[model samples]
Structures are given as structure tokens and as C-alpha cells.
Target: MTENDKPAEAHEQDGTQLARENWERYQYCVSRGHRDYTRLASRLEGFYLGGGEQWSREDLEILHEQGRPAYEFNEVMPAINAAVGYQIHNRMDIAFRPRGGDATKELAEVRTKVAKQIADNCRLHWKETEVFGDGMIQQRGFFDVRMGYDDAVLGELSISVLDPLDVMPDPDAKSYDPKDWADVTVSKWLTLDEIEGQYGKDARLRAEGARALGDEDFGEGDDDGTSRNKFGWQDTGRYDAEYAGGGPRRLRVIDRQKRVLSQMQVAIFPGGDVRQLAGDEKPEVLEQLRANGAFITRRMMKRVRWIVSTCDALLHDTWSPYDRFTVVPFFPYFRRGKTRGMVDNAVGPQEALNKAVSQYVHIINTTANSGWAVEQDSLTNMTTEQLEEFGASTGLVVEYATGKRPPQKIQPNQVPAGVDRIIDRAAGTLKEVTVPDAMRGTQGPETSGIAIQSKQFAAQQGLAVPLDNLARTRAMVADWIDYAITKYYDSERVFRITKTDPLSGKEVEEELTINQWVPESGGYLNDMTSGEYDVVVTEQPMQVTFENGQFQQAMEMRGAGVRVPDSVVIRHSNLTDKHEIIQQMEAASATPPDPLAEAEAVLAQARARLAEAQAERARAEAVNKSIEGMFSSAQTATLVAQNPAIATAADGMWKSAGGIDKDAAPAIPSIDAPAVAPPEQNTNPLTPANPSVGMNAGIEGGQP
Candidate 1:
């Protein structure tokens, strides 16, 4: 059968009218985005880089001639963007607060660990979102966070931020002030790839690819099986030649434009959450699970991708990918004096100031260049061509000497009065809208302490609305991270766990099974899923810590008479990462010092001293007994013969009294006392006092 005779099936999409219908809807969303962002992108870039089409032609010429202008003194918008960006980048703190049944401490801690790990990994990504979002929040006045899971492809969960310009809600929408999207949020991005990758290698994608080829040039030669008319016009490739602009054309009329649209619509159902339901009420709610569906379509040029997918969201069981994800929309400086994000607060003042500065620069250059009119008399020597050259190069005009005039300055609005004033006034307006002068470090010395503080507070207050939103964003991101890990990161991961090792107290890194950390599971991390969780975006208060950190703080508190544990101190110290070691230190410090143990230590020393004293006493006693036996006779004689002052009666047998004191005392033994005559009576017969050298030794060490 001929190509047309083969019916619609011979073409692409396998005859599905549904795909075509979806393509039409996607086209509308994409067109809306293009319309909204067409001017916005260029405007934001103009502010950032200092040029835009909105500037007058003269201004553009000046800028084009000058390249980038030095007149972009309006750093206020950037300063605001930077100030908010820095805060979010450095201090977008968050915590995983569990809700519903899984809110126990065990689960909370597990989720916290999971959240921390995820945060550590995705912190940069989140900040990047904030940084770009800050610009949008400052420029367009709103931004959003889009979360997804493709770990099999991305290695971990992903949070792809949708650029504010691409976030198309509704064309008639006055503001991005929806409290919640009871319906849907559509995101559109243009891809330059000729092949639609989202559809894998499907027939529909192949069809779009074929359409994008632009021309069908199958060989006109007879051998290639393509026919050529007498006029030499060749038929388009494989498909039937009956159609115009190539047969089986896949792209739609709107898609014909070079930009292809990748449209993702997250349609949240009204009742995806049933946590509040009674136990018996759950079964009925599950029946409506299909209501929480998400649709992603890849439209290539005029054609629609065949493989459009719709799935039940694991997150919130809604049309959202973030059952665990959060959309932390930032509108730190929302207008309307309300909490919702509005069009750029600085848009008006900023654009005004940019124009004023550019013009001021141009005027200043003009005044400096053409201020003096050249004397025509001086140019008389030069030709017309030479004078023209001089005029063009110097921006000066030639004047005839009219009785002449010397070269004089030409003053436009010679008063020049309002020029500076206008420029200064514009600058002031821009500055007023921004917070670099207050919330940041640029406070002037003349600014009083109270004023400075007030400014800071005002700056903080200004951010309050967005901060609140960011907090929600953080909580959602954190919750989603936990959810992602629980659901996706099931493999063994050596998670850093902080706790005391029962035996030693000090900070340390210990690994806990991811599954065990999560409250409900005693299994591996893979075994667990974040069944349900709640997230809380919090600005973790910057603790006033000394250079010594938590450790120093702990020491100071201790010095101040406040008892604090080393581990607790470590938590505040540089050893925060070593939580386990700190915990161990805390555990060890908690045990009370043992009084009985101290007593035992003292008793052991006392016993050693007593043993030494006994040995000395024994030696003294043995020596005294031996001396009495040896010196009895001579001592007795000496005691009897000497006067009482010089000699007293000796008690030992070896130290008896002199002169027969033995007879008076009932015959103490005296063998050979030299008779009391002359030199011999000096008791030479008495042996030296005996000392029992071996006595103490024998008593102590069994010496002979």
C-alpha cells in the first residue's frame, strides 16, 4: 500500500491522539513561560552586567562604545542579593523533625544523622539554589526548589532548582502568592539537543528526531529506491511522499519554533496525606492514591514525545516528587508589606538608577569632550578634511573667529545644578531599598550604636518573611533528604556516629549502620525507608563560642564553677566530628571517684612503713642486751670508785659499779676487774660493748 493508503499508523506516535492532546497543553505552558521571561531575563542580566535593551539608543551606543560601564554604582540590588545569598549559603541551617508515629527520640536521631549526611552532601547544591534564587527573589521576587530521585542515574537524590523565569504558573496570574498549590506547578526548560533523551530510544522520540532533520533527502538515484519527478524534485525519506514539508511530520504548529520544551507538571491532589486519619479510615484513603500523579512530557519542536509518563508519587502520595521534598521558596524582600513574594522591590528604583547613572556618565563624557569650541582662525591653516577629522576625534566644533572669540566653553544647561542632584537622589533611593549598609558591615562611624543595631534588626526583620519561607524550604529539603536516603541509599554506608564508647571517654568517630540509626529498623540502611517524616527549617543559633570552641566553653564554664562534662565540651569544641569520642569522655567522667579505693591506696603505704620500723626496733633491743653481758665487771668497778656526779651505777652486768658494789648488791658477777690501783683500774679488762649484728638481720631475713 502507498504511504497515505497505509493510514495514520504508517506515521509516528503509533496513532495515539492522546499524546497529541498532551503536547498541546505542554505547548501552552511553554509559550506562557517564554512570554513572561522574555523581558525578565534580559532585565536581570542588565542589572547584573550593566546593559539592557530598555536603555535608550544613545545609552546603548555609549555602553556599546564603552563596553561595560563603570557607572553601575547601583550595587544595592547585588548587595541585597549578596547579603541574602551569603546568609542562606552560610547559615541555611536545618533539622529533621519527625512527625506522626515515627517521632520518637530514636527515630529522630536516626533521621537527624540521615539528614546531616544528606545536608553535608547537598548543602552546596541547596546554596546554589539559594544563590540563584536570591537573585530571582530580589529580581522577580520569588523562587522554588524542585526535588527528585534518580540515584540509579545521579548517585544520590537530586534537588534541581527551577529558575524563576521558567516557573510558569498561570499567564493571568498576578503574583506568585499562592499559599499552597492546591492544583499544580508547571516547570518548562528549553533543550538544544536534536534528540529527545527523556523518551529513551522510543518510536516517538525517533519520530521527533526525524522531523527535526528539516529535509528528507532520500537518494533520487534509481538504485536507492527513491523516485524523482521530471522536474527533479525528490521525495522525502522512508515515509509516504504524499504529505507536504516532509511526510509524517511529528512536531505541532507551535513546536515548529527552534526551541523544544521539556515540560514537567507536578499536580498535587487535595488529600494525599492521611496521617490524621483513624486507623480504620486508612484503607479508604489508599483507594485514592492514583489521584497523586505526576506528568512529564518531552515535546520536540512540533512533535510530542511518545513516552509520556504518569506515576504515583512516593512522596506525600501526591502528584509531587517530594513526599519528602520541600519547596523553600525565597522572597526575603517581598513587597506589599505582606509575607508573599512580589515583583522585584528594587526593580523600579534599580532600573531608574541604572538609567540615571548611564546618562550621567554619558553627559560627563560629553561635557569633558566638547566643553571648548575650537577657534576657527586656528583651523584656517588646515583643510576642511583636516578640521572635520579634528572635530570628530576631539568631539569639538569649529567656530569662526567673530571679532572674535577665543575658544570658549559651551555649557548645556550651564547651571549643571540638577544633574548631580538627580544622580545623588537616584543613588539614595536604590540604597534605601537595599540592606548592605545595615545588615552587613558597611555601617558608618556616624551611625550610632543604636541606629546600627536598629538597622541590623530591620535588615533581619526585612528578611523575616523570606526567612520564614526559607525555613520551610530547609525543613522540606531536610525531610526529603532523609526520605531520599531512607528510600534510595539502602547500601552499607559508613555513617559517622557520635556516642561514648562505654570503656573510654573522649571524642571519636564511630560508624553506625544506617538502618540501625533509623528508629524502626534493626537492619541495614537499605532495609529502612523513611515511612513518614516531618522537616523543620531552623536557623541553628550561632553559639557564642571562644576560640577554644565547645571545649573552651566547657572549660570556661568549669572555671566559673559550673560542672560540665568533657564530652559535652568536646561537642562544642573542634572535636565535634568526633562525637563518639566525646560521648566516651562524658561517660567516663560521669563515674564518681571511689572513696574505698582511696583508702586502700593509703593503707598499702602505711603497712610498708610499719615493717621498716619494727626491724629497726629489734636491732636496738638485741644490741643493748649484748652490751650488758660484756661490760658488767668494768662498769661496776668504775661506778663504785667514782664520785656520784661523774659515775652512776651501771645497770647491766657488763656495766657494774666500781669498788665491790657487787657485794653490796648481793654479788653481781665480776670475773677480772683490774684491781682499783692506778692505770690498771681503768677497766681495761672489760670487753667492748657487744652489738648483736645478726640479731635484726635474723629476725627480718632469717640470717644466722
Candidate 2:
């Protein structure tokens, strides 16, 4: 046989054998992984919902056989609920960051906004939280990202959480990302009309025929516990006797997805232009490309493909447009090549707590009140029956033989002190194993806010791995969404998202479009298909607290004269009207200052300076006048000393005006000149302080 003919012969194999092989592999996978995990996960979910022992009929029977009541004192629910609540309380958002060229950065912003709008439209937060809660309770969670047209020309991106039991991944594969798995199978129960609507009438007819073949030929589904928990009792019988038309005829439709090797041709031209051909080109197309100076090269790659089949027939086969598996699996606590949940450790203690509390209640019920021990001869108006009925009544009168010792009271049986302690310890152990008191917001009355915050932070740190796992999964989902955007959104489309603007702190509707034609570049602007983005998950467990702290810090900086921007301060504030407030601030900034007011302020300052200068000048002139008078007196004294007649006349004038009194004041120096005078007799106030001073000293000192 020729090598190329082998695939044709393989494809010619009987449909029944192919179906058998696929179904058997699916069964094998279910046996090895899905079935056992489903059972455990279901029980864990029961425990989380306060019904842990509800389906354990054998255990309840055993307890009843032992004369104990069957009860479920659910201490597990609180811890699990608290853990789930913690995720809900601290909401997170997914962001896309550019990892390529400058164009990628611009596209990333538009994509980020588009992603947020998609998330809001699909209510992604609720789905994410649901998946997280399931993972915490059941050890695994899944998300499905896909494009849906919904009867429109343009496709929309959607994300949904899938039930863990409904998805069967490769049992031996150990990877956090689903794209790395060897294969995965997803099963759904759909009515014939539903299947026909999705896969066409021909496919639906074949699936219906397969359903009629019974377990011997088509094989029975191993979905006893799993499907019942999720889909609730799917009737897989050939025909429903209770219904007139077989009750819509539901069938198990399995989509087995895997990657297959494929080849693509890359054509390189002389002008450095390259194009990829998907190996389906005609001879003429290749010859034309060769004539255009193109070098053709082939490269082998793996591409995602999935098959739709029932137990007896292969319905369809197709390749996925997206780069990887659409379903993303998140294992919060993957260890030792296996995935386990936070609830795993707490399950044992939780059961013990339930049993302990149940047993304690039984003890109280059986031994709470005491019975009487009475003398037989002691009889009054009351018989033994009456005494049994009324003996415990208050103010009861019992007439007995006078000396018959009063009926003695029997001691009541007490529940053992250790039972209470056991229940408490089991409950505490359950909490410790799962969430702990700190995470549950338990604290002493005297606990300071700082101390409480510290404890809460420590508790959060303990669960950081799981939170990180969730974040990583979200990043993968974001990447998938980005891929869908590039692949499906080839035309300009508006994405209207309602969000709180980071700058304004207000809920506003934002619209953005991608792949719009740009005449300047002669190509599309914001070409989403041409760039790469890295997904960054922004967790906001304390968004309010963070924003409040930022706002306070900004205000303080402004108070300290730090020139902080009003826009920045407004952005961090929590006011609902911040958009309006910001708008006012921007408008005020854009408006010009009043020129007349500025001039008036400058003039006021100038006038104050002028008054100060005038006052300074007047003080200087008064001092100058006093100094001139002193200098004139000294000059006159110098002239008088040169002529004795003037000195004698001045002395007479001084004496006549009573300028000098010998008894009260020292005698003034005489104007009459002497060749030399005694120093003690020199009483003139204007005399040079230093005998050797220069004659021009006064003039020089008074020059300015």
C-alpha cells in the first residue's frame, strides 16, 4: 500500500469501531480520574452545603443500629463559606499589558477596555467567583472561553464556568494549563432538537439511532454520581414510558478535543513580504506565487481539533480557530502531581465534629431528666402512676403513710464534660484546617485595628497560593479573550462598557472600536491581530481601603505645599460626584486669571514699599540735621580759639545766659586760646573724643 493511501483506508474504518474506540477511551479516562474525583467532590460539596451525611445511608443506618440519632451538625459549612466569602469580598479584575512594539501598547489599552466591557456583559465576576468557590470546595475549576455570533454578523466573546464533573481531562497529564494537556472530553445532555439546532439534523439522527442501540452496542455512560449532582438525573433509556414522545429524547453528546500535527506554507517574496499558506493552495496559486519571485517553505505545527461523537457514531470533526484549547482548568492546590483542595484537610475533622456533636445531643436527650425511686408502701392521694406523672410538678402534695420515708429523688444523668470539649476541639480543628478564625473576622473586643489587619493579612498570606492559582488562570482566560478579539473582530465594532472612570471615579459608558481604517497609514489603526499582550490580573481585596489611603496621602501632600494635582487627588477620592468636581477643576484651570486683579495686587505691594522708603528717608534727614548742628558748634569753637577777643565775648554771653553754673555743672572749656591746657579742665562736650583724631573726621562721618 502507498503511504498516502493508509490514511484513506484508516478513514474507511467502520463507524461503529471508531465510536467504540473513542467511547472506550472516554470510559477508561472516567474510570481512572473523573469517577472517583466526582464522588469525592460531590461529598465535599455536600459537606459545604450542610448535608455531608445526607446521602450516607449506610453510615446513618449504622448510627441508628448503635442507638444514636443520625445528624449533621455542619461545622464544615462555616469555614468553607468564609473562605468563599473572602474571595467574593476581595474582588479582582483582569488587565492586558503590551508585550511587543509601541503599536501593541496602544492596542493593549483598547483591548483592556474591550475586555472589561466583555466581562461586564457576561457577568464574568460571578462566574469567576463561582469557579473559585468550586475549586476551593472540590479541588478543581474550569472556564470556557469562546466566540458566539448569536444570529449576528459580528461575533462576541463570552466566558462561562463549567462543572468539574462534566469535563474529563487526560488522567496522566499534569499541567495547570489545559492547552498543555494531551486531550480533554466534555459531555453534555441535550435534547434531539437542541442537538439538531447545533450540529444539524443529520448528526442528530445518527446520535438518536446510537441512543436506541442499548448498552450492549453503544455502552452505558459512567455518570452515576457526577451527572446527577450537576444535571440532575438524565434519563438515558431508549424510550421513556412515562412520556408520550419519549420526553424530547435527550442524548449524551461528547466533544473530544485534542491537538493534531498539521503543515502550513510560508511564502517569502523579494521585497521582504511574507505570507502564510495553510497547505490547501491550488497548483495555479503556487505557480503564480513562484512567478512573482516567492520562495515557498513548509513548516509542521500542532493545531487544535475536536470531534463530536456519541457512543455509537462519529458525528463531526473540525479544527478550532483559536490557538489553544478553549477550556481552561485551574487547580488551586496542585501538589505531588495531583490536585487537592483546601477542604480536603478539613473533611475528616468536620465529620468528627458532626459525630461528636450528634452523640452529645443523643446523650442529653436520653439522660437529661431523672426518674423517681419510691417506697412501695408509701401511698397517698396519688398512685404510682399519678406520682410518676405529677411527682416532678411544683407544689405537689403527696399523702403517704405518716412515717413512710418521703420518696427519694433519683439523681439525673449528666452528659460527660469531655464530650463538650471534644466537639469544641473538633470544630476548632476544622477551622484551623480550612480558613481559621482570623480569616473569619473573629477577634477579641480589645483587638486594635492594626492588629486585626495584621492577623487578616497573615491569614490571607496562607491562602496566597490558591489565590495566585486563580489569578494565573484568569490571565490565561484574558489571553484567550484577546485571541478571540484578534480573530473574530476584523471589522470596526463599538464596545460599550459601563465602568468607573479611573480619573473621575464615576460610572460612565465608554465606547471603543478596533480595526478602523486609517488613511494616513493606508491600513487599519488599532489592528488587534498584529500585536501581543500579557495578561495581568489586578486583585482588589482592599480597593476601598487602598483608595482611601491614597486620597488621604494626596491631601496631606497638598497640605504640605507639595503641589499635588487636583486631578490626582480627585481620582483617588470616593465621592460619587467626582466627575463633576473634576470637570469644574479642569474648567477653572483652563480659564485665565483676572489681569486687573493681578495689577491691583502688584500696585498695593509697590505702595507699601514706597511708604517704607519715605519713612526711612525722613529718619535719615533728622539725624543729618543734628550732626550738622554739632559740627557747626565745633567749627565756631575752632574760630573762637584762633581769636581771643571772640573767646572772651562768648564767655561773657555764656555767663549772661546762665549756660554754666559752677555748683551744679562742670565748667565748660573757655573759648580763649591757650598754648597748652590741663586735661582735667577741658569740659567742652564737642571736644574730639581722641586727642589725635583727624580734623576732617566729623565731615567724613557725616558725608552720607
Candidate 3:
């Protein structure tokens, strides 16, 4: 057949089969591959090198064209062959590509070319080999070199070729062959499913073995002499042979004792019995064992023995084990009953003696003859015989009784016999009595001892004089003092009456009364003249004048004659005249002419005029000053003749009708004006009239 029409031959013996198998395997690999290539590349140097590097689009396209075909042929095809086996190869002739069929041959030729081109152009390569060892054999396919860029190598592409029968397992029994195959290939030598089954079987076997060996080593009995085993005692042969029937039996006494010892060993040294001592006196036991060359001391045993001995000694008092024992008395000193004499004899006797002495001293000091008693009211009112009897009764022991006599009695409505004589005598002895004028004028006699006693009694009862009455009395006295001073100052006998000014028609009648000048009047009178005068005029006299549209005034003394100008009348006339003048000026200037715009225009014009005037005046002044200060008379004369005003009025009138009138022009100006001339024709100052001219002639000709 022609090359284009020929059916493509498979590169390997089962290319279609291999393609299908490897395709399935590659799909599984890509699905199952961990996205940890970068990490794996970093750890494993040869497996994958360039990490974190992206494949360019062009590179990816190239790889697609070259690497994809090789992958399909070498890797995917082999995996599919291993998975689907002869089925893919057999079906390929009719299903995908049939020999001598138009469609099948065309596809086959295209695929064949693609595979050949990939194998020729790509950097990757592949190899296949059969591995046979230990009870199994299988075909393995691997890539020679992985597709890569620069120094980076992608993962090795590979697939396994298994026997056709090996791929499918029976549904009834467990799949052991696949499990075994998995055991050979994976890193751990076990698939997840196999590991799970083995783990379950191991657990079941462990349970069974544990049941068979139940409690045999512990032997049932505990350290407290109780059975350790849960299964009770029973005949073994007569019981049914059930799985539950077999169990640990109860332990014996000897075994329990051994268990107790083992427990003690564990408690003492958890590491082991050989590492510890068994005794209460651990240090001493250790020292003894060391001295005796023992590897370890029995500290627990020593402790048990010591406890037993101590208990035995406590039970049986032998050899006086302790030197002395403390004895706490049942009753302490404070709790004991006191002796009878402590309360009744010693303390009671002393207290009684103190009380009796105190009473005796009190009685003796209170007796009448103790000198503390004086002649009180009782003795004073008593008769001489009665006082003597009282002194004897009171045991006063006195030689004689000097008693006070009673006061003489006063009869009602009858003065005493000496009272009249005393009054007459007092009248004649007034010189000796020396009564004060205030006391003599009093209507009642001066209060004696009775009045003073009555007053003192009233005061003790919190009695007080009336405050309002006392205040009124004080006010009356103050008013009297004020009246006396006022009358003294107003007394005409002491002061002469004089009028400050007489009225025009009447004589000065009873001079101005000084009595009118009271503090309420806010003034004092002149003492010598007895005339009323103002002490202060707080209201100052002010005179105001209105003149020339203003008002003013002046103040003068009340008595001093002051003539004030008639400012009100003068100011009225002046204001009238000012108003008239203002009205006239307003009438004259009050024409509204687009006022704001006119003002602006006027202001602008004024500004322009001011600027021009300033410039011209400044220039004229400068010329005048310059010429005046110069050293030439000609300049001065010229400057004088250049005065515009002088020129205008040369003949007493400005004669400038239009241009340069002869009379209006200056005769001798400070700076001369150039002579005026008519314009010349055909002047070309900007061009050279001849080409041969030098620069100097050109410049001179260029000047206008």
C-alpha cells in the first residue's frame, strides 16, 4: 500500500493497548499526585530541579507538540495496556482505526507520523524491561529522561505492565493477588486496604490470645488476702466447653504473699526490687548492708520489723523505755479553791480597819469644837444661856460665849427716836454730809442695805431692766445734749446780729437767725454775727451760653455779683445767619447731573491734568533752576526768554493763533528748539545709495 494510505504499525507490540492502559494510569497519577512538586524538588536534588519556574507559552506549545506524543506512546499507552490489556489492542482495528478502511487508515497514518515525529524531536526518552524475582514477575516501563527546561527535570514518567488475568479479581473471595502486587510496589510494601485488613486480623488474634492467657500470671489473690480473679471455683470437666468457660482461677495463700512482696518492692523502688531497700530505718539498713557487702538493702522488711518491735514495746513496758513522761496536773493553780483566811481574815480585816479609821476621823472633824465651826446663824440668834447649853451639848468646851445682839426693831408709821434727831442733825451737818446735787434733787431717799439685798435677789431670778425704756432714756439724753449745743450756738447774748446784705426797701429786721443753721439744714451759722450761712452748696451754679451755633455757661458765687452775657439771644441770631448761608450755598450747588458718572469722569480728567501739570511744571522748574545755577549768562538769558507765560504775554497778550506765532514764540530759551524746515524729497536713509560705500558712509547715510 502507498505510504499515505497504509495503516500505521504499532511501535511496541501492543501500542494501542499500551496507550489505553497508560492513559488510564496517567489519569490516575495526575489525579492522585500531591501538589508539592516545589517542596519535593527542594528536598530531592535529582527528581525535580527547577522549582517555582513557570513554563513559557512557547515552551508549553513545544512541549505539547513533542512531549505529548511520547507520553501517549511510552507512558500512557503502556499504562492503558497494563490496565485494559489485549482488549484495547483487539478493539483498535475496528473501534478506533481499521486496516484498509478510509477513516481508520487516515487516523492511523496521522498517529504514526505524530509518534515518530515526537520520538525524533523531543528531549525525553523511554525504556521498558521485565522484572522477575521472588515468586512474581512483571513488565515495568520508565522514561529515560524526563522532559525539562534548562536544569530542571520534571518527574519520571512510568507505568507497570501486569498480566491480563492479574488486573481483574474474583468478586466472592478477597483480592489477594492485587494486595500482594501492591505490597511489592508501594514504598511501605502495603496498600491501604491490605493494611486495614491486616490490622483488623491482628486485633482479633490479640483478643483471642489474651483470652487464652487470662490472669494466669497474677494468680488471683491480692495483698489484702482477697481473691484477685473474677472467675469463681468450679469443676472444669463437667462444665460445657464454651468459649466463656475458660478464665483465671483464684490464687493460693503463698501466691498472695508473693504478690504482697512484689507490691512492696514496687512501692519502695518503682525501677525494680534490686534498686531499693525494704525497711523503716532506711539509712541504717543501707549502711549495714554496705558494711556487710550487700548489693541492696531490704529497707521495707527492716521498716516492718521496726514497726512490729515498736508496737510490742508499747504493749509491754520493758526495761523502762523512756526516761520520763510529762505529767500535766488535772487542776492548775488559778483553778484551785482559795483558803478561807484569804477572803475573810487577811483582806477583810484590813478593809474593816481602814473603814473604821476613816469614820472616826470624819466624826472628830465634824464636831463643834474642831475650830472649823464659826458663830453662824444658830449661835447668833441664840440667848446666852441657850448658847451655853448648846456648847455643852455639842462638847464645845468654851470658857465664855460672846454672842451677837439682835438688831433694834423698827415700828410701823413711827420713825426711830434718833431718826428726827438724825434728820435735824443731818440738816445742820449738811456741811459734813456733803450731798451731791443730783442726789439731793432726787425725790426718794438713797437705797440702803435692804434695797441692795432686794436688787441682788431680783438679779438672781434673771430679772432685767427693760431695754426699750433704757434706749429711750439714752435717746432723750442725746437729744438734750444736742439741744444744749444748738441753743448755745444760737444764743444772741453771746453773738452779735449782723445782716450780710440788706434788702432794697426794708431794714434788716431780726438778723438772719443762727438757729436756722442746724445740721439738718446742712450749714453752720457765723458765731460772731449770728447769721445763717451755707456750709456746702453741693448744687453748683452753672451758666450756659448758646452762641454761634454753640452753647456755653459760667458759674459764680451766690453772694458775689456775676454778670453773664446774653449767649442764648446772640447764639439764636448767629444760628439764623448760618442757616441762611448754608441754605443759599445748598441752592447754588444742588444740580443733579448723573452725579456718580460725572464725578468719576471729572476725577479722571483732574488726575490727567494734575499729572500733565506736574510734568510740565517739573520740567520748567528744572530748566529754570539749571540755567540759574549755570556759569553762563547766555543760558540764564535764554531760560528767562523761554518762560511760556512771558512769551504769551510778550506784548501784554497771548498771540498764539495756531502754530508758531512770532509773538507767542520764545526769544531766548534755555534749551533752543531746533529750526523748522520743509521736508526733502527722495530721501532713502535706510538704504545704501551705492554699493561701494564703507560702513561709515553707510551709517551716515542711514541717519534720518
**Best-performing candidate as measured by lDDT:** 2
* lDDT tens digits, residue span 1-704, model 2: 66456674465355557667677877788788688888888777777787544337688878878888767777667777777777776766767787643336667788877777777878888898889988988888898888877745677887888888788888878777776788888876666787788778877767767853332211234453443453334455344334546456566667778878887566677666555554555575565467657789976767677777777777766666555787888787986449888888877887787778888888776553356777888987889898877776778787888888777777767788988998889878877778878876779889876687678778887688888888788788777777676556666786666777666555887667677877988666676655456787787757666787799899999999999888888888898877889888877888988999899999999999999999999999999778776865675565555554556566666688876565643223555446444123233436744344433345522222
Candidate 3 lDDT tens digits, 417-536: 643444344333321212222222222466664454344333322101211222222232222222222222223222223222211211232323222345776633332211111111
Tell me how far the alpha carbon of residue 701 in candidate 2 is from the true structure, in angstroms, after superposition: 14
Give Cα-based local distance difference scores for all models: 0.45, 0.72, 0.27
Instruction: Summing lDDT over every window of 10 consecutive residues in candidate 1, give the lowest-scoring window.
Output: 309-318
Candidate 1: tens digits of C-alpha lDDT, residues 1-704 = 76467665544333344334444544565565444453454454445444343354576676677654634554544655645454554455555555543245566666666666655665544564554454444343233433344444425655555444433343443433433332223322212132244333453344443332212333233211212233444443343235555434222211111112333322233334322111222332233223223122222221112223111100011122233113334444434422222224555766666666766676665655354555546444455456544643644555454475555556654426766777677667655655446766467688776576566656666555655655554555565565566444654455676644533444468765654344566333423342445666555442432324456667888999998855466555565466677556667878998999989989988998999899999999899777764564454455445333223223343254343444454343333443453333222223322343322232221123
Off by over 4 Å in 1: 1-15, 30-34, 51-59, 62-70, 96-99, 124-155, 170-198, 203-343, 358-415, 444-455, 482-507, 514-533, 541-704
TM-score of 2: 0.76
TM-scores for every candidate against the unseen true structure: 0.52, 0.76, 0.10
Cα lDDT of candidate 1 equals 0.45
Q: Please give the distance, in angstroms, between residue 118's alpha carbon in candidate 2 and its true position after superposition.
A: 2.9
lDDT of 1 at 108: 65
Which of candidates 1 and 3 reaches a greater lDDT? 1
